[model samples]
Target: MAQAITAERGQWYKRLDLDENFEVVAIDRDEECIEIQYYSGEIEEIDEASWELLEIAPIAPPDNWSGAFGSDNRVEFEAQADSLETALNMVDNSN
Candidate 1:
């Protein structure tokens, strides 16, 4: 199933079509566009159609979970990180 994004300011998203990561800077409901700041520091306005190509960025596991794992489950922690990277790569290659 596809993930749902709230599209709020400061939220990060990965553009599936471009393999680029961007953060939401603003949303113009009247214009139906979202202002995004790319990882490269470029700002652009994307319409609803363009927004459809984006997915919410993967976030790290919660601090409490990490604390529970501590150092004994280093391999499992790495695997989780790798999984997120793979998911992002899949999104990039989808287009």
Candidate 2:
């Protein structure tokens, strides 16, 4: 089974098609460099001075539990995603 990204840091959303194989794309931002894994994964490099650890929930299917306390839980569900590359390409070619 595919793994859900447990954290947001080092992780970014890409709309690349998940069904196809493609070369990795490199992106540079300030002093950080990131590798687009299409729809698979991402690689990011951050300065040690700026690195911080944050707790993140792992991706999981919905449990259908509902209540006052469960309201926030339902919000954490993730939906299906298209290829990250396709989405980025659309933005790049847009006028």
Candidate 3:
């Protein structure tokens, strides 16, 4: 059976079970900091200095990408930009 996120007033934690054998705790936090529990039963407190890592976007290329065109249909590339404005510029400059 899969474990679902059933919110409780004082739960203040999120967990995930993998392979029906091990579990992964995604977020276990209180008022001050967060804690993580691994499958090996090792518990570690996430450092405040590295908290910014959670806010970072995980993407090799951003979603705002403009497709590239070539004389050959099979030869094509994509222009991935950090912002919509930049993606528009990449597509509009083809002319």
Candidate 4:
């Protein structure tokens, strides 16, 4: 059976088409807005119409929820990614 999609706060979802993941961070009924935080730490507020159009399905929490540091540390995280590659290269050269 296909599981129904619910917009409850803190729920994680995988956008099937984009192959991306995000979480429901907030919902304001008065404003008819839903705030979501992507795994990459991008925040977006969507209205009911937009939310209905999203082709998403509920999913387990990501193994690594680095969205905690969020977009604020995006540059720093990106730098660390480069450092990770450099470390891998060093390991390869040591072989």
Candidate No. with top TM-score = 4
Compare candidates 2 and 4 on lDDT and give the better one.
4
Query: How many steric overlaps does candidate 4 have?
Result: 0
- Looking at candidate 2, the ten consecutive residues that score lowest on lDDT are 61-70
Q: TM-score of predicted model 4?
A: 0.64
Global lDDT scores for all candidate models: 0.58, 0.32, 0.32, 0.70
Runs of candidate 1 with Cα error greater than 4 angstroms are 1-4, 55-95
> How do the residues 7-93 of candidate 3 rate in per-residue lDDT, one tens digit apiece?
221111323222211111233445434444333445555543433343221122222122211223212323254454443355457
lDDT of 4 by residue, 20-94 (tens): 898777789999999888888788899966888888999887655545434464455545554433433443454
Report the number of the highest-lDDT candidate: 4
Of the pair 2 and 4, which is ahead by TM-score?
4
Position 47, candidate 1: lDDT: 91
In candidate 4, the residue pairs with backbone N, CA or C atoms under 3 Å apart (3 or more residues apart, or in different chains) clash, namely none
Determine which window of 10 residues in candidate 3 has minimal summed lDDT. Answer: 16-25
- Candidate 2 residue pairs in backbone clash: 14-84, 15-83, 15-84, 15-85, 16-83, 16-84, 16-85, 17-83
lDDT of the structure predicted as candidate 4 = 0.70
* Decoy 1 TM-score against native: 0.49
lDDT of 3 at 87: 38
The RMSD (Cα, Å) of candidate 2 is 13.8
Model 1 lDDT on a 0 to 1 scale:
0.58
Kindly list the per-residue Cα lDDT of model 2 for residues 1-95, writing each as its tens digit.
23243223223333223332222234455655434332222333433233223122323212321111122322332222243344335434543
